[model samples]
Target: MQEQANLNRRNFIRISALTGGGLVLGFNYFLTSCSTSQDGGQVIELNAFVKIDTKGRVTIMSPNPEVGQGVKTSLPMLVAEELDVDWKEIKIEQAGLDTVNYKRQVAGGSGSVRESWESFRKVGATARQMLISAAAAAWGVPAAECATENGHVVYKGKKKTYGELVEQAAKLPVPENVAVKPATAFRIIGQRTRNVDNHAIVTGQYKYGIDTKREGMLYATIIRPPAFGMTLESLDDAEAKRSPGVQQVLRFDNKIAVLGRSTWEVMQAAKKVKPQWKEDGTLESTADYTEKLHGILAKKPEDKPRRQDGNIGQAFAKAAKVIELAFDAPFLAHNTMEPMNFFAHVTADGAELYGPIQTPERARGRIAELLKLPEEKISVMMTRMGGGFGRRLMTDFVEEAAMVSRLAGNVPVNVIWSREDDMTGGFYRPMCSYRYKAALNGNNELVAWHHHSAGVSGGGASPDSFPAGAVPNFQVDAHTYKSPVTTAPWRGPTHNYIAFSEQSFLDEIARQAGKDPVALRLELLEQARANPVGKVNYEPDRFAAVIKKAAEIGGWGKSKGENIFQGFAAHFSFASYVAQVAEVEKQADGKLKLKKIYCVVDCGTVVNPSGAETQVEGSIIDGIGHAMYAELTLTNGRPDQSNFHNYRMIRMREAPAVEIHFIQSSVAPTGLGEPCLPPAGAALANAVFAASGVRLLDQPFIKSGLFA
Candidate 1:
């Protein structure tokens, strides 16, 4: 199936002739062949991304959804760079969901730039070479002598704008293998490029999923089960249907929805509807879950060993000192600024969905399955998301919208989840617990390391996490506890919690050994570099480089006046290494203040320096906010926190100054979206320890009562 899809994507490129003698290049991933004229003559296959018009304007299609990660601008920058066009001459348009052509249009995992770096550059280079070939033929000069610069091809002293040569270029066959410019030749990839949609976003002209509209679209709000593991037994929607502007009230297997002309009307009507849910009484509260976790740990469930080395029993038996600790992290809500919402128009013939989805292909597939329709009949369009952070990866909301539209007499429907609905909705980061034990010899040399983690089946630390291969005797065991609360991947997934637990515990070991935390980590990295045991997933040199660079940038070990202290941490995730040093101070009111953060990353080959830095800063702030305040507790199987008022985020006043540095390397770039986040929580926790002398064994430090 995939091979067929690939072939279809390559067989054709849709090219539309502009009214003013220009070309518009569009791609349909499902097209099996090129469309020909009625005369049965071969049509020109303009299978390239670059488009040129009579006015010399260049338009590039950004193939991925932009969730404020700057992908819309950065991806187009790749094409503009290889096309050798001036930045001012380019315009960007968001491409619709095209799995076959785009080949992974999803925006999660921070893999956008990593996956597109070479492919997008080739797109531009192919077009540039074709245009150069056309210009050289017209000038009667060798193609090798013709060079492209600033949207024009130059041969000796004669030059022609790409617009003047595009018609001829469209007729020329695309090169099978085009040579893209080297990193040194990059003029836009590593430069500071402004976001293409900044003006629209700032001026409120940009259309998000919630802003989507159609001629006769009705608004909908679903009334879901009040508690986890509950079923909708009955619902009374008579009041809802009687409300002003309420069009209809429909009931599904698990939800009752109110449809109305306006969002306000639907929301008001939904509030009047009451749903009775049936609970099994087996669902446990957060406190009960914590107790169960402890019980599971105490019973020492059969070891699902992920990694094992030398015998840990002997090492610990002979050790002079053994330190053990437990860490806990509660379930977390994504709380995307734009709540879950989607616009769908389902008809007897086909279905159309539009929203801020990170995985449009997955949504399309699920919707097709639900509707019992062919995949080709369903269209999923992506809108700029307010924020994703892994929440948009799920297609539940999209499917709900399609279902609502189908039940509303095939009329277009916009399903919008209120802030409260979004918070209470399932699909949270799984609550987890980690138990760690370390053994040290008389010389205080690290000897044995044992780690056991338990969480919702799919979420937890990777077996090959840092220090895994650095220790002489290392073993990792994992267990899972099933829960009714639905769980999915959070920003960094398991790394977010694991980093805090592992790094903070390493700091504890450093204290026990009377060694500086940074120096201790450096020592372990040096050991891994010298004689690594087992398979080391990260580059020891790259890991150590960021740590050293962050230390230097942060002025580590330097006095920062009274009551101010710094803490350091480093981790590897998503094929990138990041190290952070956080400076913290205690306020007069006893609250913690994060003054500054210094971060160094080595994700290899920076795509856009400005965008990369912005992502790192944003990740750090998100990490700090979640670490300090974000928590979703449960009571009677329902989420306790409803909105930002209780589930606090990092306010502007609480945001710290972040300084980021990227290592210069020629290797292929990796993901930056998630790597920086893992270490931020650990760095902040370590810094808080330095300032308050309090160890945080759990997340959302506000609950620790140390600040109070």
Candidate 2:
């Protein structure tokens, strides 16, 4: 009943109006339909952020968090590109929950630009049509003769900026078929533009999730069980209550929440408030976990088959030469710059939640589940994310805020997770291991390939993705192990591991067969492109293009003298293809120093060059961290490394000088968030082998002596 009611209300609010200059265009977000009359302003959805006021001012409501991924600028660029409005007149606002129109507001997987591109343009095209019709009516000319430029509509010798005709446009009929500019005619896209939020970032006025402040809002800190699956047994809060500014210490069924005047007070009180826990089971060491994973893989196939090819056992037996290698990636934490935080005001009628989150709609449902309230009564306000990576997707922090508010007798509560708590308590990227093998015939031709992967079990659900290559036989399998710690997508998810093993193994094959790695890949790509196999997931030509481009840019066939070494790798994800080459030099002490990195990508159309470059550079920096130093270790179910000091990220001095080049194409824009991450691992590892003759099969390359 509640769901139905909520759905009904959503439908009722789905169509609204935006009013300006006698215009009456319906002003729902992209999904909502708006109509305009010949004379005045149109009503629009309350959640609609991008609306043209009668004054012809462009207002953009950002639905996703902006943690430096340039969503604030790129997303609005899409809308403005179609709207034909003057960019200077645009005003930006962070959007509130009006799930009636927003879709895929969650920003992760580099899906922001790709997913929102079409919808944003639709919104702008609709608005532009309405403004043009109004101007045509006022000038007594055919609407087709009236063209819009710089917020103005001109027909013959007559001209009127949208602002001058908005009153008339408000009354003009909304055109049913709004015309969108073709790529050839694009004026706003494929152009380098500065980040829309740069001013806010420079001035330190950007409102991150942590910057949210409300009158009489009390701060909170949660104390979770130290060990996974543990139940709270007891609490000692007397000392915490005595701490300065500590207002209350509330104990719930599974945890304790400290409420206080300031974040520091909450943090100080949380430290003093000791909580006892009863272990749910015995702890397992990392080695034990590894053994367990192998055992699971060796056992029977339980779920549906992910992928299968010609009989693997028969193919292996027929081969004269077979090679096998194992690879592993340690658990990773998203470690978003801003710790988890949510401010919730729960009252009798409904609830209001404000903070940093990727998916406001998903957060609303999660809040409803935790608070046991109707979804309609809940409104989530998504603010700028300080850095999501993948950490902000989890709603544990939001749930904690609601729990604190519920316990506080309906008073509003702001739950703040200290950096330590967030690092230790949030979901982690699952650790994974891969066992790969390939069989070669007597003629030294590759015949079969197989990959068996195990770990926290996120990948094997779908066999590793590959193009229809020249290989005759292939098989992919997955093994799962139940983990105490919750897991979520970190960067590229499974592709991060698969790319390292597959690409590195391919390199090995090329070396053994006396063929150039790039040449071999190109040969297989030709087969795939000529007669593609069943259910292949990637484009053969695009994949080969990136490889070829990277090779040329890196001077692959050429060599430098003793000190410098080069390696290459390529990967496709988020509907895009990227290839990279790494140049490394060895220090006298046998330490590896990455000198220059070259990358080429074919991600369809470019949205914003500045935004695209930022994401690519950031992805490279992040990948370097994962390859060289980032890892979260567990000791008795508790994370051993809790802060940046212990679990290191790449510092400025360590970042290799990088060159990024894009393929000029007319394909639709694909995801740019994570495409560059996977190849960095293999490229760096391959470079390590070139520099020091070591093929590190595991991650945190430093631990494997790849760096030293």
Candidate 3:
């Protein structure tokens, strides 16, 4: 049957187009890590690498690790959507270790949708178009008259499944230009579909970053220096080796890595290997971090302006009223549900690795650089990520795993980073402070605005929509500090901090001008829409649309029940737009309780209502976690908060009921993963000011006792 299928594929037009493009796709299929099948029978590579047989069964090539974010299911949706296959008949596969065929397998920056959207469509459409051409040639009908549906071609009331035409299609020359379906006629692109891996997740059949099992695999734990930049002096490995189940103790650079039979055994044995180390005093305390940032900000402003508009000094002088507010937001951890972990096996010529990595390409380079091997020799497989939030984007954990495994002499090694290690070992959202000054004319309209932010510069941070100079008379600049702890892209990055400061200041300016906060912003947005001030970075129409949508959906001007106040904010990031209105009540004792949240978005086209909604809800939770109770502070040169017990995520009981609605548009989709974040912080701050007459200037709002 398999031989016949291969022969038929050779004759099919589908094969011609798929293979032609497959060649151009530069898919080096040889790199997929292969091992014996689960039943210990035949050799099989990771199923993520899918292949279609002559029978027209579609195969998927998934590369991104699936965390709860649904890449496992959603990434495949793109392929299936363009293939015109029956959703019920679709068979999904985890992509094998093939770097040539797949790039950007790592899923961070909410980039999976944005990056894969075009690639998957081309792959599917190429195959379908080829199949249609083959059927057209075989039936002696005009190719234009042949339409493909459910993996078949039909013309003049005659139909045949792709399987029947495969042999003939393979014989036809591959068409250079295959017609693609019109967006208006799409059957699956915008429809709601449940996650493909839902059952696996709910039933515990889903393999997470830490769930892989390998033959003769050993577990390893690293005893890192008590502080960053510290060097290992000596270690008594005999004691660790004496422990039952302990395998070997390897020392390298600045630490000792203990490998053992199981995770628990390695962990237990690592505790006994007390290696001495010399601290470089590179560990920074909160005071040091703050002082350094303050000093950086105090420097003479570099004339290299990030943003500028109308003469801000002149506008301030002409203004009737002016208000200034300084706000601060602290450092935060990504705190993804799954800590960093990776499995690796090293051979003399090559290495195979599996982990919950967000940047597989980046990981490949890092591994090759560290292991000193040809890049092609290392195979990095991305598994289902437990949760990235952005932490998995760093390949440090994967590097450690590969190194340990290589030293273990061919035995597969699983390197696990405990929550404590993860919290402290990884980079964090940079700490920041913002200073803003806004002026208003006699008519109570915003006139001039200047915002200056200081702290660790938001260099290479993901949600790069900040420095939101949407006003006619505005100026924005940021100052950064050099610190030992690394910082990766947090959910919204600079937007998270800027929105809180800018929006809160806007609220204050509105109060000083004796105008409603939402109305004040609407006026500014209207100005941005009509005679958009300066060459700002915002899409004025989309920006205005979100505000209008939120107002309509949220009953913006309506009063809340007694003692409740509503705050509103909108921001665009990840190439998409999001706006939110948060309703809050300030308790007598000063507790801020989020009652309800209304979110409006325009992500171009909605792929799945349920999926989009899920993303929105998750973003809200993520944002709320940062706003209410999440922080990673340092004390005495060490991370004061380590695990979930110290650095908290919002629990189910604390999550606000979120309502999400998207504007209708046929435009190409943008992004939904990170756009909703900035506004959550802004809206929450606005609510606090409105409800209690006391403005909560910073994040982890719970610490402010605003709700108390």
Candidate 4:
């Protein structure tokens, strides 16, 4: 039955001729990420990848936001791959936010490249097929006899530029099925091609959302409540209105917006507009959250188990020894290099929005609903983001821009959040803590595993990760607190804290069992592949392969320089397996210095090796920075750190050298933007323990006086 359905499947390709000279090819594209409209509905978006000009130039339109994940450069390679064109011969453009033409253009979860792999290949292949048919019809030969090579359709001793045949090809009937090239035929792909916008970016010619400008546009800055759980009581904007360059001051919800001629003027004036506020909810602090998290796990309640295997009580009763440990991680701020900013011109007729938003479709839909206008009346465009890092996923800033524009006489407004406003704003990574109790038998083998994870404002840890199926008696329980604070997904949302806590716990368990951590992990992976167990989320062999590769490349357990120690950790997240080995050098004054980080990734086939390496290196550096010195704390419902001065980021002199390796596979690519990030902390924490001989259970090792 499946075979019959496969035989009946057909691709609908829509091809048309350009007005003067050339061809345009579009096809149905559905993102598998479940990315949806403002009403939570997914739509079929048409992707137009190929557009040929009279000069024989092929323009490939990338339909996703570029958030430094290399989607702008990588996604277009898929189209160029099947079109049989060299990388330098094609042009790339960032597609505007038009839901009628693009779907699921969100950049979160690293879904851009993976979701477009097959569909985009079909796009180029379909166009190639149509071009081949046109060439065959003109030459009076079989369509199969004509082949495309380097932007030209060729027959026996005869060839024609794609530009010459596109007009006739546009008139040909769309083919139901087209063949894509095999991995071996790849020319543009697997080549370490530089980012298409590298020159523009380095030359400062690239325009970000913060750089947006329009005629009659007014610069605006929001003055939100100083603290969470607060409400506006009174507003006094007389002074702000009289200030230099200050145009108007408007109040909306619990915040105030100050408009002026420039960002500098508006920012200076916003400070003068004072507003009285009252507490709407309990003012919570980080100390309170930490105490609650640590205190709750004493009971280790299993009321709602996410996954359960054999009888844990019986296994613990029969075990030789039980190891119990607890781990905690602090809340993290996204802190995107470019602060949240959006440009919106809201009039009674229509709305225009442009910004560095990660979720453009959602922004458009939201603006349409907010303004009581039809979706077609609103237009949202995406500019190159300085950095997304999951901060732009939320549409709060986008909504603010639109609302400010609407309330201010439906004028043009460019709402920008200052760095301090961005840091103090909500939607941060939730604070998380974990408790693990594992029972080991006489043979130093894991018998039972019980883990309970707690988080503020809900989830940051996964209950269905590794070691679930590798053990006989395993159970995962979780508890979440409903706090007034807002929490959102940050990078590998589920695995971010889970991997660190769980992997570190696993390392501790191995040490307690007098076994090598890597060897024990392999043993469990082998059991996962061979023995009876509960549900497993990762492929055992693939997971094991990365670990082995990291060990080989990093020289795990090998000799190193004086005062140098190594740590190992592996995790699977976003459908990718990653293993990292961190090397640390212990200073004479009981400090830890990063020596290097070795990362091995099994994200299937890498689309762009250069970009892929940058992602891995970035994740390592980011994870290391956070683990070493970065921390975000709250005091009486207010963030303690406002900017880089107070919030300690890793410095350039402290940046460690990194080595990255990827497993070569013919499978479709999985997530790469975030998978490598989760394991960095895990490996770093373990390496800290190895170097300092201290079992670190909490994050921000620098604050713990372990790292300088």
lDDT values, one for every candidate: 0.83, 0.76, 0.71, 0.84
Q: List residue ranges in candidate 1 displaced over 4 A.
A: 1-48, 587-591
TM-scores of the models, in the order given: 0.94, 0.94, 0.90, 0.95
**Total residue pair clashes for candidate 3:** 25
User: Cα RMSDs of all predictions?
Assistant: 3.5, 3.9, 5.7, 4.5
Worst 10-residue lDDT window, candidate 3: 1-10
Clash count of each predicted structure: 0, 33, 25, 0
State in Å the error of residue 270, model 3. Answer: 1.5
In TM-score terms, which candidate is top?
A: 4
lDDT of 4 by residue, 293-370 (tens): 888777758577877899888999999999999888888888889999999999988998998989988888888888
Per-residue lDDT tens digits for candidate 3, residues 347-450, read 88888988788777888889888889898898877787777877777788888888888777877999987777777767888888667778777886777877
Better of 2 and 3 by TM-score: 2
Candidate 2 C-alpha RMSD relative to the actual structure: 3.9
Worst 10 residues of 4 by lDDT: 1-10
Give per-residue CA lDDT, model 1, range 1-708, as digits (tens).
231222223554534333224443333323222221111122233332455665567877787878888989888888789889999778777777766656668888878887777667766776688789989899888999889899999988899998787666666655555688988898887888778888888998988999988999999998888788788888888888889999999998589889989989999988899888898557678998888777777776486688888888899999999999899999999999999999999999899999999999999999999999999899878899998888999989998899999988999999999999999984799888889999999999899999988785355857899898899899888877887788889998889889999999999999999999999999999989998989899999999999999999999999988878898999999899999999988777877778899999999998888888989999999998899889888988888988888888878888889999998999888999889998898998899899888988998987777552
Query: Candidate 4, clashing residue pairs?
Result: none
Q: Tens digit of lDDT per residue, candidate 2, span 57-171?
A: 6676667666667887888888888878767777776667776656667777777787776667766776787678877777778887788887878888788777677665545
